[model samples]
Target: MLRLFAALPLPPEISRPLRKLQKDLVGARWRPEENFHVTLCFFGELRHTQARDLDELLGEIEAPAPTLSLEGAGWFGRREPTAVWARVRESDELRGLASACERAARRLSIPLERRPFTPHVTLAYCHATLLEDARAWTERHQAYSSEPWQAGAFHLYSSQKRDGGPSRYIAEADYPLSGFTAPEGMY
Candidate 1:
């Protein structure tokens, strides 16, 4: 079985700025630079053939590359914080890409958690008692903004846990946005 998800990888230009926001949060396990991405849809695990089929279907998507922007910061849990993330400015183009990915999951008969699509790049997972600290940190960095850039493509990634080491995420395939030049015809 293969564990996978679809995501938009952040360019170095954008990722550099985001790295600065990772500091000053106590009791938080910050994510690595290689793990930074805006997830479109998460498909936990699938059979080998199922993964191949999904990859084929995902490559057929043809949306224009959307210019993405970052704004503010927030935590996932309300009272007891569990995660800290940088918010993505919402756009119809972004939503369309996410919806298309969700549709692809459904077509593959993958059961997905039904919830409002909230797009954000998670920065860290925090201890539960740090709610106050998380909020204060959020407020301090509320005016944050990153230079907008075009999302040239989306990727399928596998999140693997290493023995006695941090979980590492690896990109398995890339599907370029319509109108973008696909390197070596990789779709």
Candidate 2:
């Protein structure tokens, strides 16, 4: 069995700017820059058969690709600071893609999330001490915005357990966004 999900990977051009923001928040227990991504759906601990069926189902999906922009910052777990993340200003494209992924998951007999979708790139987790600092940094740089980027494709990822740390992720499959094109096939 493997833990898996579909997600949008951050492009280097976008990530470079975010990394600069990372530098400004010194002393915070930030997520490693490479781990940054916007999750579409998380499928935890599925059998190999399920994973293959999921990939096949996803391949048949067709939806217009949407452009996404990271507008600001937000915190989850207000009390203990479970996470710090960048906010996705509401976009119909993003919501549509998320809904499509959910439908695909349901068709494969995977459990669907009951919670509403909130799109954000998680920046840090497990740091109770970083809450105040995170809030402060967010206030100072709340105006930060990235150039709109294409959501050309989303991937299915496998998460592997790790000792004393966050789980590691590996891309299992990538589904191209309909009506979207990638430059140089980079993704």
**Top model number, lDDT:** 1
> Residues 70-166, candidate 2, lDDT per residue (tens digit)?
9888767666657667887768888888888888889977887687799988876645446677678678668988888888888899988789766
lDDT for 13 (candidate 2):
79
lDDT of 2 at 60: 86
lDDT of each: 0.88, 0.79
Q: How would you encode candidate 1's per-residue C-alpha lDDT over 29-129 as one tens digit per residue? A: 88888788999998888888988989999998989898889999988887788889999998988999999998998998998877688889999988754
* Model 1 misplaced stretches (Cα beyond 4 Å): 181-187
**TM-score: model 1 vs. ground truth:** 0.92
TM-score of 2: 0.87
> Against the true structure, candidate 2 has what lDDT?
0.79
Clashing residue pairs, backbone N/CA/C < 3 A, model 2? none
The regions of model 2 sitting more than 4 angstroms off are 23-28, 163-166, 183-187
Which candidate number has the best TM-score? 1
Q: Candidate 1: minimum summed lDDT over ten consecutive residues — where?
A: 178-187
